[model samples]
Target: MDRTELAQVLTRARTALTPQDVGLPAGSRRRVAGLRREEVAQLAGVSVDYVVRLEQGRGPHPSAQVLSALARALRMDDDARAELFHLAGSAPPMPGTVDEHVRPSVQRLLDRLDDLPTMVLSARGDILAWNSLASALLGDWSLIPRRERNIIWQRFLGTPDPRRSTVAMDDDERRATDAQAVATLRATTARYPRDPAVQELVSELRRRSERFDELWRAGGSSTSWPFDRKAIDHPSLGRITLDCDSLHVPSSDQTVIVYSAEPGTPDSDALALLRVLGTQSMTTAG
Candidate 1:
């Protein structure tokens, strides 16, 4: 690996980003010119020590996965991402692989939706990006490891966040959701049969989660609904039901998931409150 060049590039990228670029608050009295090392660590789901070591040109060779996370965290463009992979002595993601990179336009769209809880998910159900309000309504996704960021993984294998407790859904609705996730994942695997990441994710989930295993074995298919309702247990807001809508991006094979509440309702008021509070209240409470 070109450790020196890698270190320089990583440092440059980190310093170029402001907190607001990554849906983080820009608090006053900051000493850093751009994002701090800890902030990059949080966004990349890596340790501060790791980031420090990497930037110092003394860290061990990062895996492709780590490089991918860092690229996303740094908001690298296509050319920059390719250079990062080359510097790390790894190949850039091929065409058939799951596209995790959120386009600049999509990122801007998320920023525009300031009041609603919005997130982008890959074909394999991995959460690729999210807005600040989404973090407030759900948990701070940045805190979760990149490998565990998939909605299918969270649904079947992840331990529930105590703060968000249960996603209140009827038995039928819950079952349907599970089936859809599995079917979607299955379809993704078929489309990218040679993708090791997709293969590994499915293998690991089937080995670890009994529910996932059962659904996978059943070979059931369900039509993915564009809209659904979910009652999420917010730590500060209590139970709030919101309309969950899925908008597909066909070019990238990604989905933008948005959560909205009807106007003039209690849930709408709660969402408005959440917008004002941002993620500060949740962070403090946790």
Candidate 2:
């Protein structure tokens, strides 16, 4: 990579963006045009030091995810995004690959949904981000290693809450869930044959789980993911059942899982309690 050119390009890009462009408050105490380093860092989900290093031609190459985030933060169009990747000495992510780039708009949505148990999952089932309530409802996914942070992997190979999830599944429901998961994985493999991470996941699942392989061979697929209810048997909160709905993001092909209960219900009360517990744990850990 031409560090000088890369730095110049990065600085130019950063200087070309404005607060209004990336969903930030327009401020009056501005000494310069475009976004500040801290603003860029916040929008890109990175640190200010990292942005400074990138602009100064001293940092290591940013990963694809970082590049994508920066491109989005700068409000670059598709062509500009491609040029940014080229200048950074990395090829732009091609179509058909699983997009790991969760847009800032999507991330903002997650951050704003503090009361709900929400999580973002990549097309291949990788857990990208989760809210505090999601951590309380499901396991704290962030603490898990990257390799084990996948829903399909967790279901098939990893030790996941041996004492059945509060999202109660009868035998038939279990079978359906397994089939759906396998189908999703199989579809991902078909979509991104060249993605090594995705390929490894599929290979590992097929080798490690007989049921996964059987379902894969049987070709489980549907038009879309189904809306379902989850019952989580919280060790403290007892059983809390909530409606589980998924929203598809066209830009990234990611799914956002939202957990909610009808207002004023007992389940809603339980979720509120879980939120309290989640907040307390975060505070204690901090």
Candidate 3:
């Protein structure tokens, strides 16, 4: 690895981002111009010591997973992400792989949807980027481990955490959701047959989740749910139903999932309340 250059690049990238850019609170304590090392560690899901060592040009070469996390945390574009991999003596993700890097345009789109809960998901259902409201409406995805940040993984193998759970649904809705998730994953595996990450996810799900295995065995070609509405059982706000829409980013094979309620409705009011209460709760928790 080009330790010195990698260190320099990492430092530069870190300094270029503000806490707010990455859905972090900008506290009054002002010591650094950009995000602190701890903040980057939190965002990248790495240890603060690792971030420090890398910045000091003494850390071991980061694995592809670490590099990808750092790239996402740094909000690096495709070119910058490729450069990061090169500096680490690792090959940049190839074309056939599921794209995890969120394009700058997509990131901006997420940012602009300030009132709505929005997130970008890869073709394989990996949660790549999300807005603050998304965290509030769904769950704080950043707190989840990198490997478990996938929708399918959460649906099947993830431990039950009420705080992190998605919308509340009945058994019928749950089965439908599970089937859709499996079908979507099946379609993704077909599209990126050589992608190790996709293969690994499927293998683990089949091994661990009997329900997932059953659906996978009885495969279908459908990639979307027949229904788009969902009801979230918020701890504070009770049940709030919203229209969940998925917008496709065909260029990168990504989908931008957005949650919205009808304007001037109770659900809309509840969402607005979440914009304030949820952020404060997150900041306090952090």
The best candidate in terms of TM-score: 3
Q: Candidate 2 regions off by >4 Å?
A: 1-88, 161-166, 279-286
Q: For model 1, what is the alpha-carbon lDDT of residue 46?
A: 89
Considering summed lDDT, which 10 consecutive residues are worst modelled in model 1? 220-229
The global Cα lDDT (0 to 1) of model 2 is 0.75
Error of 3 at 249 (Å): 0.3
- TM-score of every candidate: 0.93, 0.69, 0.94
User: What tens-digit string does per-residue lDDT give for candidate 2 at 186-269?
Assistant: 777777788877988888988999988889889856535544788777755678888999999988889999999999999999
Candidate 1 has an lDDT of 0.86
Model 3 lDDT tens row, 1-286: 9999999999999999887687665778779878899888877888899999999999998998899889999999999999999999999988898888889999999889878888889998888888888877777777887788888898898887756535788899889888988888898988999899999999999999999999999979566633488888776567899999999998999999899999999999999899887644432343
lDDT of 3: 0.86
For candidate 2, the per-residue lDDT at 153 reads 87
lDDT of 2 at 275: 65
On a 0 to 1 TM-score scale, where does candidate 1 land against the true structure? 0.93
lDDT-superior candidate, 2 or 3: 3
- Is 1 or 2 the stronger prediction by lDDT? 1
Structure candidate 1, residue pairs in collision: none
Task: Pull out the clashing pairs in model 2.
Answer: 166-231, 166-232, 166-233, 167-231
As a TM-score, model 3 comes out at: 0.94
